[model samples]
Structures are given as structure tokens and as C-alpha cells.
Target: MHYLDNLLLNTDSYKASHWLQYPPRTDATFFYVESRGGVYDRTLFFGLQTILKEYLGRPVTHAHVDEARDLFAAHGEPFNEAGWRRVVDRHEGRLPLRIRAVAEGSVVPTHQALVTIESTDPDAFWVPSYIETLLLRLWYPVTVATVSWHARQTLRQFLERTSDDVEAQLPFKLHDFGARGVSSAESAAIGGLSHLVNFLGTDTVAGLLAARAYYHEPMAGFSIPAAEHSTITAWGRDREVDAYRNMLRQFARPGSIVAVVSDSYDIFKAVSEHWGQTLRDEVIESGATVVIRPDSGDPADVVHQCLQRLDEAFGHVVNGKGFKVLNHVRVIQGDGIDPTSLRAILERITSAGYATDNLAFGMGGALLQRLDRDTQKFALKCSAARVDGCWIDVYKEPVTDKGKTSKRGRMTLARNAATGHYRTVPLADEAVSLDVADAPAGYEDAMVTVWENGTLLRDWTLAQVRERAAAERL
Candidate 1:
């Protein structure tokens, strides 16, 4: 068996010794994951289903146990050999854990419980925290999806304000360009797919593959024929016009779109002399929309200049919203783009009387590789534990950092039907009164059991996830 397939060895070294440290007679431990508030007010819950389907759906084998035992023994860490062997022999190597989570693609408020896990068997009390190292990595996809969702909101705002057809243009406004900018192919696949949860345009093939393989989607993203610096500059500076014309001749069919990078020599010269003057008639006569890409200089300024040049050459028509929509031309700014810069460029364009339909954005590093766990302040903490036979709340409240304090007791994510607001509430018990008039009226648990033991209880498709993400948030 491959090392990564060995669940026993796929965690922090400290986890190997945690089984010994739990209080005597501890029966089970409950843990939950949440975003403790950072960057965004809400998070688009995602990627947990992929992780569950990929890692936890398989049963462990004796070979995995033997490998883990040898590795931990040689590495000077205490191994839970007996416990693992018992799991293999008695449970057929299926992990005895129950995982509950908010539905994938739900846009949940920060600082609320998003996922909960607990051991389902008395002998597997240590299983919850043992897998923390792997499970907590959900922070990556969740953060990426949250950022992309917020970007979608920003683009939707601008499109609504400046474009006549907001719905027609909003979904393709932000395109994923982060595949090469990420750390590994796996990171690209996961982060790229997360971005696609909110937008339909992408250049990351790995993300599309991940969506298909993990989420049962045939195709999760779309891309048009586009040019890179190498493809454009390799034509030599003198033949730049030929390069531009070739892109049109090769890919620009009636009603189709093609993008060509125009900054190889001078973006202004390429737009003015080549696209605007020499090939202006061909661009118009082709009956296709030609997308001009400016890959250098200040994004807002360059985009503004490109739009100005394109408008001067091809002209524009006033949309019903009274904003200028360039004729047969558009600009895609792929450089120095993040949420802040993207909004800045849109504001600049809208202020200049240009519709959001005249522009789109392609984000790279900022979309995938730039964030960390603290970007959304994600945390997984022990909330309740079973000691002897009684369940008790467990939490940490450090005086030095009040923000790090975790929740107490077993919790459930409850949503108020009337207000569409969400809050974390303690699971109802004998001591807790949930029927009070002052309590959250019309509140119901929004979390569902997604994984139990080694079985996947619910499977979410990419199309369903996209629909949930596109729904208007209350």
C-alpha cells in the first residue's frame, strides 16, 4: 500500500501519542471546525465532500497497520497498534467516526460551526483528533471558494450598476488563471475547482478534471482560445500584426470569442496601428468578438487606455443602462489582479462611463496560492468529550488572545427562517431549554450527516453546488 493510503500514518507525529494522553475511561471526543472570522464575513462551505470521497471512503488494511506501526516505532513515537488492529479486524478497517457538515456550497457566516466530527465507537475515542491534520486542510478550498464568492458579489454589483444584461455577463466576469501559480498540481486542481464554484470561466484544466472526478460533473468550466506571451512574442516584434491576424483567422468564427495578448511590443501601438487600423475591418467582418489582453503596466490605467483605444477604433453603443458598450471588442486584464485591484479597475471603468460588460478579469496567485489558514481564521477544536460515562464541555479561553477562545459543548448550526441568519447553538439537552419564546424563533439545524463510519452518507454534484453558490444570500 502506498504511504498516503495508510490513514494511521497520515497525521501529525504527536497524534500517535494522543491515545495515551486522553483521560482514563474516556469514551468519545467531539470536535468541530469553524471560521473564527477573518477577511470575509461569510464563507462558502465546500471541498469537504471531495476530501471524504477521496480519503475516508476506503477501508484500512493490515498492511497499512503494519507500515504505520513500524514507522512510528522507528521514529520514537508511541503507536496505537492494538487500537488500529482492532479496527482492522472488527470493523473491517472502516473508521468509526461520524462527520456532520453544512451542505457543500452553502454560504455560511463566519465564526459558526461548519463541520462536526466525533468517534462513533467507545474504543475509537481518539480517532477524531487523530485525523485533524488531514481534515483541517479544508481551510484551503473553503478560503478559495469564499474569496471567489466575494469576488462574484463584487462583479455582480458592478454589472448590475453598469450593464443592461447583468445575468448574461456576470458569470464569466472572473476567470481562474491560478493553475500554474499554485504550489502543486493538486493545489491547482482544488483551488481552481473552488473558484469555479462561483464562476464558469477558467483556464485551469486540472480544476475541471477534479470537478468531474470528485463531484460527478461532465464539465465544470469553460475557456476560449487565448494567447500567452510566448505565443504572441514568438512571432518577433516586426510580425506582431501577423500574429494578431492569425489568432483571428484561426479561432474567430461567427459569434465566437478569441483573446490575443497585445503587450509584446507596445500595447497601445498594437491596439492602434494593428488592431485599430490595419485589421479593424477584418475584426469587424469576421463576425466574432475579439478580446484584447493587456498583460503589463498598471491594470486599471492600462485597461482604461485599451478600452479607450478600442472604442475610438471600433466605436460603441449606449446600452439601456446608459453605459458605453464597446463594439465587437473587450478587454481581459490578467495582471496584478486580486479582489482589491479588480474592484479598483471596475470602479475606474464605470467612472469613465464604460459598462462592466466591456471588461473581464483573470486572477492567478491571489486566487489560489496567496492565502493561508489565518486568512479566514479557520480552527478545529474539541468542543465536548465523554469522560467515564458523562459528556462534558471542553474548550480553551486564553486570556492573552480572546479571539482564540473556542466554543463549548456539543453545538449545532441553526438558521433563523424569518431572518435568514445563522448561529451556533448548543445541542438541546435536559439542561438546555430550546423552546423559550426569547430563543431563536423558527430556527432549525442546517447541518446534515455527510459521513458515517467508512460510508459516504450524502454525495453532492458540482452542478448542485454551483446552483447553491449562485443563489442570492439573505
Candidate 2:
């Protein structure tokens, strides 16, 4: 019996996320053997599940097939299940010795292999190295978790300026709309899960599936004919109303989220003018509001202008006449968004007399890629070094501090009590002073464990990473 238990589900133990789902779906099982370039991404399920199961000390239930021998099912059709079983029988008990990473979800800078493995038993390890492509497939989640904190900050800044009414009437929404923005399926799924911890919408159904499977959280989904993409893009901007209304009616989804791209023509006019007021009314009257999307121009200016028009046209939604706003329609800023641009837009929108809560951010390119052209939010690197063998890490040196070498051996990582600064102590020789109650706020240690034993230790939900980032004030 493979009954799953949530024993290690506590905040510090397993990865805790906001859009947390109860159970992770095991749609499929894969074995990613380790190699020189990278370690096995899926090699430690046996260890992890075993450890977790033992901790629970009960009947364990989970979805997975033991593939220590041959993998007839995983190879799919044409491999012949019989042949696969034979192959598995021939290779049973053959595996290399690999060390798991120190901690999961810890930031590892560029150049240092996130997860590394070397076989104590080379013969066993040799067989697994043949599967690099498979292992990389699972790297997306780590990659997404890699940058989850930054995305959270962008949302936090926007949420800070929200007003009581706007927040009361409209909701603050963040979405995992990064499928098209990512390079591969694994990346999309993992990144999607990482973000789902805090955001509200995901355009990719696959992302939702992965979230349900891994995090077990139900996330928001996006529907097509969204503001009737075909209609709006097909016809002239002026025809947006008729097209939008027709599409909204034809594909009327109860409590549907209909986002109208306002920049099709004149952005200002699009918001101010009552285009297919009936459709807007439909959304509002139906208790759902139309979501306005601005895919062009300055998001700040557009949002400010849009809010003013909504207020003028509807007349203080709190009143009977103007108050007819249920889902009167909120603004969602798309187009180009980076951390800086996001910060700028949020600040500008707030200063322009609109509550940040009234709008949503649909961050696409910026959230997915780390590009030089766009703003650089943070740098992940192997900043210091721990000496070879029986290594001890030293951030400070008694001699030439200029060398700035890292003390390495095994390490003990802890938050400085008084100062709240992050520091690392060498594993073997424990002889330095690391405690400080007044470590000064704002300074925190950065080396985080990204991978170990070809497995991922930390599976941070979007919210946890985000909260850490917020408190760190990055």
C-alpha cells in the first residue's frame, strides 16, 4: 500500500507554499541518472520518500514504480514490457555512491554546479550517466524556485499602495503566466508551481496540472477568447466593443475572467468610452467584472487614466448609479515588465491617484528569463571558496583579508541573533565567533543549497520565497 502521508509537510521540513495543494500527483515516474555535468534530478525519491515514510512511521501511500532494475513502462511503447523487465533484472542493485546536497532552496551562485554527484561505486554510477537529457527535464522547478523571491517583491511593492475601497471591491491578483515565456515544458511547470504560491492566474493548463501534482494547490486558470483575442486582433480597435461583447456572450463563462486589451487603439479612449457597455454590464451585473488589459504604452499612465475614467463614467462605484460595479473591470498590465519597470509602474500608478490593489500584474518575459537587456535584480555566484579536502570556509582571513577566501569544511549556517546577519562556519574546526544579537538589519547570508545527490531538497512555494525576499528587503 502506497498511502501518502503529510508528516514532513511542516513549514521548515518540506517546501511550504501559499497555493499549497494537499497531495502531489505522480502522473509519471522518471529516472535521471547522474553525469559529470550535473547530478540526477530524480535519484533521491527513494531516499526522500523513505526518510519521510519512516518519519511518519505508518503505511506510506504515494505513486511511483521501483525502477532500480529495468524500466519497461517508462520507455513507453515499442520497448516491449517483457524486454524492459529483463533489462531491469540484469541491472538490479547497480548504482553509484552519490552525496545529497547540503540543503534545498538555498541560493547557489552561477558556475558552482547546483547539485553534484560522484559514484563511490563507479561501475554503478557509469550506467546512470547515460541520461543527461532526462535529468535536465526536472531542472525547471529548481530554476523557477531559483528566482521565485524576485517575482514576489515586484508584487509586494504593487500591493503596498492599495486602498481600502479598491482592495475591498477589486482583488489583488498575481499570475503564473509564464508558459510561453519559458524555454521548455519542465521549466514552465516548475516555474509555474514556484509562482503559484502567491499569484492568482496561470495561462497554462499544464502548469495547473504540475501544481496540483507537486504542491497540491488549486490555482486560477485562464480561458481563451480572452477579450476575444481573435476578434480584437482581427478587427480594428474601434470594433473592439462589438467583437468583445459578441465573444463574451458567445463564450459566456459564469464568473469568467474576461480581459480586454485596451491598447488596441487609443488606450485612453478604450477605457473612457463605453464599448459594448452591455458586455461590461454583463460582467458587473453577473457579479464578475471585466479585467482590462493594457498591452501597450506606459502601464502607469494607462492605469491612472483608466481608473479616472472608470470613476467618472461609473461615478464613485460606492453610489447606486456608479456603484453598479461588481466586476466593473480592473486593470491588468502586460507588455514588457522587469523588476525595475515593475517597481516604477507600481510607484507611478500609486502616485497617480489609483489604488495598486485595483490592478493585476501579468509579468511574462521578466519573470522567466535572466537577461542583460532587462534590469538585473540580483546576482547568484560562488563568491567565496572553501579550501580543498577537509576544507574550512573563511569569509574573513587572519592574514591578508585581501585574498577573501571562503572557509570551507562542512559548514554550520545560522542567522546571527543580535545582528540578523547570515554567516557560515567551517565544519571541522569549530573555533570562531558567530553569534551577534545586533547583527544589524538588512545584512543576510546568501549561500543557499540548490541541489544535492542529484535531488532537490528545497521546493519553496512562491509565497515562502517571496516572504523571505520581502523581509530581506531585496
Candidate 3:
């Protein structure tokens, strides 16, 4: 991982240590005391406790023992923190709760409750439901996924530019570079993971850590630019060739691909005069490749011209089919490239005789920080909520067929047998029963038992989570 290791959230990197200190993070020690009146009403105590446990991924640690607080039931005593902890211990990590939802990669529209949570404990029902809105606050939206889906489509345009029947995998990596730019740590990690699921990227490495332990999957890594000590000097025509040759020699290798931030001096002259010939032969002979990243200039023009330079070098670098020298120096593009910019650049590059295989686009700010016209470039919505003592699915109904419209109250989202995409419909009352085979999944089933008696049931490695999200994307 090119990014920092360990968790940005309160979670511990070491699972054992995290479990030992788990109680502090769960509600057993703190009842989210503020929202008490709103969520923990008189009739829904048990469900609230359950919801807290689920969210914390652990059991209630300060289990109250004095249960006769409601001195109405048999041997009922008001339980203290210890007593409640005992209840959690006795039940192990298995609480009678259920949650379900569309798999991570599923695209949901506005107003749709994507997941639902419920339980057998009547007093505890709405309590856990309190977190329903909060959880999806992180889950639903995938700016990168939405953008990446468009990214994949956009990339196809680049590939199609070349007349070759040769199919090429995505060369330029799409990274979840949104963490520092996100509102919260959890949101950043989960949002990054969502993109990884729908596209290939390694933004929130912690999500990868969780995914890997939860589900065995492959994780991606970024090749970071090195700079223990860095210096930049403006170059004139005289020093251009030497600067290009030196940098090219420094990073090129058999399996290594080096990207030189071109445009340091004279953008076009520097490449054609200094880089084009020597850089091309080295990459081809060394069985490696070189990429030119012009940070300052119009992306479309620079990329188009960069391709033309590579075309000029192609004739000089060829040796054999696989061993062919840098006959194809892919245009490594970045500066000021958003989805719109990406489309324009690809269109221009293809028109100039460049194959996507011979080019890669690296996007940073523009793509990572795009805004939504719906006033939500991407937002996680509460798809379903526990209302009127029962859980119901929800979705967005297009009111004016304009922007985001109606919020469907209770609905079931299912993949049409004919089409893999989801189709939203009403959730039946029969789903309340666990044994109902056709019961549509809800937020309750999606709730995985992470903790027990203030102890995590098992460890989930970030690599696991990253891997799972990656596989889900495929």
C-alpha cells in the first residue's frame, strides 16, 4: 500500500489488542446517551442494546445485572453494567438479530433504504434501528464507483480508438484517493472500499485490511513516487536532453515503469529532442516501459502530442514482437483530468492514432473531488428504516423525472432474473419471519456479529476486506 498503514479510525491494527480494549468503543460503556429520548423509547430497550452491540461489532460489555429495574417480570431486576455484561457473555456473540441488503456493488438510487435491521427483542427493536440511518450514512454512495463505472465506459472509448482487435486491460490504475478529502474516516475508508468493489483501486487501505480477513481476496497497491530529497530546476533547450536522459536512466528497468513529470522545461521540445529516442530504446531493450506525465498544460493537447512523439520513436526501438523496444511509450496523463477531461483526452488521443494499451491516464484532484448536480455527487442514503414497529424497505420514486424524486417507504429490491440489475418492489409482510425462504433480505441479516461480551468474535484483517471489495467489483 502506498498510503499509511494501521487504521485511521479508532479501530486497532492488532485484532487481539483491539478485542481486549473493545468495551470502550461499544455502547455498553456509553449509551449514546444524547439520542436516548429519540431512539431508546420506553418500549424499545432490548433492540436498542442489540443495535449498539451490532454497530460496535461486539457484545454489551457493561452488562447490567440488577434486572428488576422493571420489577414486573419474574425475578426481573434492574441490571447494572456488570449484569448487562453478563447477559452478553452468556449469549456468546449470537444475538437473535437479522440484517440483509443488496451486495456491496449494487447501485441504489436516491430515497431507497439499502439495508434493514430488526430483532426478536421487542423493547430492543427500534433501538438497533437507530443505527439504520447511521450505517448507510457510509455505505450507499460511491462517487468513484459511479465515476468508475463511467470510467470503464470512458476507457472503452480509448480502446476503441485503436483499430486493433487486441483487447487491453485497464492500464492506468484508478485509486480511491478520497480519504483526506472525505468528511470522516469511516466514510473515507468505506467509500474507498466501495470504489474498489466496482472498479480497480486502492484508496482506503484499511478497508482492504478488513475485506481480506472477512473475505479472502486480492489487494491492490500503488507505486508511490519517491522523494527523500527532491529538487526541480527550470530547463532551457540546452539542458533538456541531459535532464531527460538522466531521469529516464534512473527509473527504467525490465519490470519497472517510470513516469517522468515532463513539461519541466520546454514540454514538446524536451520530449522530442531529449526523450523520444533514448528513452524509447531503453524501455524496449530493458523490457520495461516509460511514461510521460506533463503536469502543466491542457491535458488533451499534451496527451495528443505525447502520443505523436511516441509514434516517432516507435520505428527506432523495435527489436522483436515481445522484446520490441519503447516503440509504444504509453501517454501517462494526469493534470486537470476529470471524467469530462478523460473523455475529451481519449477522444483526441484516439484520433491521433494512439491505442489505450500504449497510453495510461492518472487522475488526481478533478476525479477524486467531483461534485454532483443532484447536489450529491454521491451520497449514502437510508434506504430502509424501522417505522411503526416494523422494518420496511424503501426506494426513490421519480417524481418529476427530473433530479432525485420520491422516497419509497417500504420496498424490496431484487435482481430481475433476466437482468442482473436490481428492480425495486414492495417488501412483503411475510419477510418478518426468519423461516420464510423467499423473505427478502433486510438490514438485520447484513448485521454481522463482530463482538461478544465486549469481545470481538473474530478478527477481520484489512487485507481481507480489501480483497472482498475487489472481488465484488469484478
Candidate 4:
């Protein structure tokens, strides 16, 4: 017989020992997690189901726990011996926690409960005790989703101003080139799928796999054969025009898109002379859209310049919105695009009388790994705990930073009466009520039961998540 070690079992080795400690007579504890609203004003709720599955795989059996126990004991049990002992004592081989969450694709305001976790059995206190460790991994995917969703919103605003059909162009406007730039294969997977939740263009196969594995999507994203500097410069600087032509010759199938890195030597010469003059007729006759990637220089300035050069070479078409789109050519600015630069590039193009659809963007590090927990101020704290069979409201208020203050008691995510906006109301709030027939008219419970001990209650597909994300703008 052979066994595969649970490699992910050591993910939370850095947790404090006090997490393993509870009151002597404690029966159970409830921990609620939220974003608390950070650098970004709003939070797009995502990735709860995905992260839960990642941390706790299908039917964690006794063999899995035995492997984890063996692995931990061999490593000298660095973090806490007592915690491992308690896990062993309580090990039924499956996680004993119940996970309740808002729907995976639901977009709610930040500082609301994204997930609430607690023990499933009244007798076991350690069931949901690992929540602080388990819940931390969720912050990254959620932040990435929020950032990418905002990028989609930003692109939609500019596209709506410049084109009549915003939906047709939105999916292809932002491409993911961040696979190689991310920290690990898993990072690429999480960050890549997060971006694809709002768009359809991607090069990250790992992210596509994540969508298939976690969200049950048959196809999550699409990309075309594209050129890099090495592919072009390998043809030598002298044969740059030949190299540009070769990309089209190779990938110029009907209705297909081919991207060529045009800034190999001189971006201006490549656009104005090579793609513009030498290969202009071939590009137009090939029945393919030629995408030119500007790899260097100031992205906003260089992209606009590339668009203008393409417009001069390929000619221009004025859409119904009266914005000019260069025919047979488009610019993909992949060099230095974050959310800030992306907005800048679009604004420059639109203000310069060019359509936003004239160009697209490919983001790398900024798309995948360039975020911190505070990007959305995510924090998971114990809001209510049962002591002596009485539910006690737990909270922390700090004098140093009022923003660091945490919410108290059980939280009810409900719509405001007058404003009709979703807001987190504490159980103690005079205007708030829960789990009753006479609850406020506008208040609807946003949180739903997603996971029970060793069983997944709800499953979502990638297309469904995309639909929920698109609804955020509407």
C-alpha cells in the first residue's frame, strides 16, 4: 500500500498557541469573518467556497489526519504540540466545522460578514477553532476579485462612453499576462480565475484549471498565440519586418486574433513602417485582427501614440458614438498596467478622440500578487461566543485607529430601511432584528448555509459567478 502525504496540512503552522486555548468550561465558539472595508471603498464578495475546498478537501478521512499527524510529529511540532494533540483527540478525519456564507458571486459592501464559521457539534469546541488559520487564505482571492471587478467597472465606464456595444468588447479588453509574474502555481490559479470572473481573455492555464476544478466550468478563459520580445528579436533587429509578417502568417486564421510584440526595436518604426507599411496589405487581407503589444515606455503615452500611428496606417472608422477606431489594428498595452495605469490609458485614448475599443490591456504582477490584506481591510474576529449556554457578544474597539474597530454581537446583513442599501447591522441595534416573522420589511438575510461537516451544500459554476459580477455594475 502507498500513501500520499497531505502537503497542505502544514499551511497554518504559523498560528499562535492561544488559538488552541479556550475557557475551561467553554462548549463552543463562533467566529465571523469580514473585510471591514479597507483601501477600497467597496468589497466584491468571492472565493469563500473555493478556499474552503482548498483547505479541507473532499471527505478528509482518518488516513489524511494520520498522515498529517505523522508529518507534524516528524517536524518537531514547531507551532503547538497541544493543538495537534487536541486535533488528534477530536480527529474523526473530517473537519467538524459548519461554514455559512453569502453566495459566492454576491457583491456586497465591505465590512459585512463574508463567512461565519462555528462548531457543528455542541460537544466539540475544537471543531471550528482553526478558523483564524483557515480564513486568512480567503483574503487574497477576495482582494484579487475586488480589484479585477473594479478594473472591469473602470473599463465598462470608458467603453460605454466610446462604443455602442460595451458588452461585446468588455471580455476581451483586459487580458491576463500575470501567470509567469505570480509567486506560485497556486497564486496564478487563484489570481487568474479571479480576473476571469469579470473577463474572458487569459493566458493562465492554471487559472483556467482552477475554474474547472473549483467552479465546475468547462471553459473559463481564452487566449491566442502571441509574440514576446524573444520570439521577435530572435529574427534579429534587421529582419523585424519579416518577423512581424511571420506572426500573421502563422496565426492569421479567419476570425482569429494574433498579437505581435511591436516594440522589439523601435515602437514607432514597427507601428508606422513595419506593421503599417510593409505588412499593411497582408494584415487587411488575412481576415484576422492584428494586435500590437507595446512592451516599453510610458504605457498611457505610448499606447495612445501606437493607436494614432495605427489609425494613420490602417485608416479609421467612426463608430456610432463618434469615437475613432483604427481599422485592422489594435494596441495591447501590457508593459506597466495596474488599476491606475489602466484607467489612465483608457482616459487618454477616449479624450484623444479614439474609441476605448481601439486598445486592450494585459496586466502581470499588478494583477496577481501586488496586493496586501489591507487592500480591502479584511479581518476575521469572534463576534459572538456561547458561554454557559448563553450567547455573548464579543467586540474590540481601539482608541488608536477608529478604523480598526470591530463589530459586536451576531451580525445581520440587511438592507437599510430608507436608503435600501445593504449594511451590516449588529444584533443589538434598535433598528435591527433577525430569524423572525416580524423582521423589518427591507431586511433580507444575505448569508446562506454553504457547508456542513464533511459536506458541501451549495456549488457554483464560473459562468454563474461571472453573471453575478456583471450585475454589480447594473
Query: Which numbered prediction scores highest in TM-score against the true structure?
Result: 1
TM-score of each: 0.97, 0.57, 0.62, 0.91
In TM-score terms, candidate 4 sits at: 0.91
Winner by TM-score between candidate 4 and candidate 1: 1
Best by lDDT: 1
lDDT: which is higher, 1 or 3? 1
Candidate 2 segments exceeding 4 Å error: 1-148, 165-172, 216-225, 235-238, 250-256, 276-284, 317-327, 372-407, 416-421, 429-474
lDDT of each: 0.91, 0.43, 0.44, 0.77
Which pairs in model 1 have colliding backbones? none
Give per-residue CA lDDT, model 1, range 1-474, as digits (tens): 665787777799999999999899999888999999999989999999878978888888898988999998999999999999889998899999889898899999899999999888899899999999999999999999999999999999998898889887887999999998888998999999999899999999999999998999988989999998899888899899999999999998899999999998899999988999999999999999999999999999999999999999999999999999999999999999999999999999999999999999999999999999999999999999889788889999999999999999887788787777898888743222234443567887778889888889899999899898889553
Clashes of each: 0, 43, 70, 0
lDDT of 1 at 445: 74
Cα lDDT of model 1 overall? 0.91
Query: How many clashes show up in model 3?
Result: 70
Q: Candidate 3 on 1-474: residue-level lDDT in tens?
A: 212221111122231122233222222110111010111111100112222333545433322222222321243322233323434665552343444443444434433334444443432332233233444333223444455555655675555545343233552344445566665655454445445543454545754653443334456344534211122344444565556566556766677766666676677865786666545565577655666667678888887776677677664332222222235365566567677888887677555445556556655444444533232322223334444544454445566753343334434444443333333445455353222255344322222333333344434433443343333221
